[model samples]
Target chain A: MEDRFEISLLLDFYGNLLTPKQKTIMELYYNEDLSLGEIAEINDTSRQAIHDLTKRCYKLLLNYEEKLSLLSKYNIREEKYKIALEDIKDRFKLSDEAINYINKLFEDINNS
Target chain B: MEDRFEISLLLDFYGNLLTPKQKTIMELYYNEDLSLGEIAEINDTSRQAIHDLTKRCYKLLLNYEEKLSLLSKYNIREEKYKIALEDIKDRFKLSDEAINYINKLFEDINNS
Candidate 1:
């Protein structure tokens, strides 16, 4: 089965908005690595129905992500964290003042 | 009038969710620096009503912010941007590889 990583990320972010049935179908299809035929049989439905529902669920999740952009914002934050951590860890041995300045910058951000 | 910067930021973020009249009142009170009396007279309402309504709108916006957290996420993103720019510009005399790496990190974030 193909690895549907993007949809998995979207699911993690917006899965709560999906109906339980739709969400289950998605989890089975993407997360559980179940074939659509197996999922349909488990749900006592046709393979075609599972296929369509999964597609619709994917679109719905995408729509939610597009409007709110919570996923994109989250990814950006992660990137920033990774970059800052790597930079401070690997390079730029600095004085106590510079270290404190960096620490204070993040402290103020967290407080805000 | 004492500066109410926080409400102004909240209004910018969650203002669209508010009722039209509520939005107008908030904008007038915070953006236009109008007194409650001035706003009440303009709307042909009691000053006390305007005062209470503005207070209510403030709480409503706060609730929206608390639940969605769009504002806090935005602040964190801004802090990251400011730090990255300051890091690249004010401090780090970087090699081409380091500059390219940082640029790629942000570009990937923007693309995502």
Candidate 2:
């Protein structure tokens, strides 16, 4: 998919929300870049099973995003932080500590 | 439980991520404030089943929070917005147009 990387990022945030089987298949297919046949062989399941599980996992992740919008909110928050940081820097020459504190906030937002 | 309200908020965000049964039970129990017996009677399931489903739903919501932390990030963002708003107001002596624009940003943060 064109948004495989984006989905991978969403998986990072909400992958644990899936069942163990779903999570394992997703890790194999997306992270490990395994083909359906390869995953089925590794897990001793039919390729169809792997395909269904992967589809279900993707749907579930999309559902989570639709309901929560966590990924979108994170991006918006990061953008706003950058804009505000720039505004602060431009309007008032902030102290080193102040800059460090804002930087820390940005890091915390990303890490969280 | 002590975090019933908090879980309800989490449910608002991630509840759609649950199964249909899980979502229904959670809605009846948490949002509608139904007892186990009431839910069981309405759903035509045993009280024990209702209780178990409720527990499972709680765990799922908690797991989602543990992984994604959307609510926590939201609170932190709101706090930072307030802090930054105050800082801008204090340091910049901004025009009314600027103040209104900042207020609009605050509203957007809260809504999103």
Candidate 3:
């Protein structure tokens, strides 16, 4: 996967692990399309505090992603699976015998 | 945005909103690079339960994304901000006066 996609996935996963306040602020700012000032007013926090929290949360998320690489590994495995599936489909189209063999093979694989 | 990118973002966001057990299964299967049997062994759950939970979580996440579109909206906004930043950077090298004006403008924008 591309670095940007990896970063986005990491951020999404890390964001879920944050505290409710942090999650709410992130959701309001990034997901809810709220301005900093608007979020500060609604949450009854100072604008500077909100900004600081947002910055800190972003840094934390990036750090977690760098250390764990969870999302990157997941993407790689997923890509591998997709390629395997496509290859099987291609083989299936080449011969009816291949199709039945592949189907049975997949069932066996799943059962095992 | 491309459909694949949108779908991936939606899945990531929706995954965040899932129950801890569902999230744990997803992380194990997708992020931890574990097989269903391996995950079942580690979680001390039946293989069928793990399989069922994983399938259910995937469908639930997709449905939530379809209903909310939170991640898609966030991605669009992020793209707009990135484009704006790039445009400002491009303008910066064209003229020193423009550079200073844009820098000041950005400061004002941030301050506001």
Global lDDT scores for all candidate models: 0.73, 0.77, 0.59
Error of 1 at A88 (Å): 3.2
Candidate 1 overall lDDT versus native:
0.73
lDDT tens per residue, model 3, A43-100? 8989999989878877777765565444554455345434544554463333545335
For candidate 3, give the docking quality class from DockQ: incorrect
Per-residue C-alpha lDDT of model 2 across residues A1-112, encoded as one tens digit per residue? 5488887877887797887778888988888899999999999999999988888888888987887677897788677767765775565566666656655755564554
TM-score (chain B) of candidate 1: 0.75
| TM (B chain), model 3 | 0.64
Q: CA shift at B6, candidate 2, in angstroms?
A: 0.5
Better of 2 and 3 by lDDT: 2
Docking band of candidate 2: acceptable
Which parts of model 3 have CA positions greater than 4 angstroms off? Answer: A1-8, A94-112, B1-112
* Predictions in order: chain A TM-score: 0.75, 0.84, 0.66
Candidate numbers sorted by lDDT from highest down: 2, 1, 3
Best by DockQ: 2
**Maximum-lDDT candidate:** 2
Can you rank all candidates by TM-score, best first? 2, 1, 3
Off by over 4 Å in 2: A15-68, A72-112, B95-101
- Write the number of the candidate with greater DockQ, choosing between 1 and 3: 1
Quote the lDDT for A11 in model 3.
Answer: 53
Better of 2 and 3 by TM-score: 2
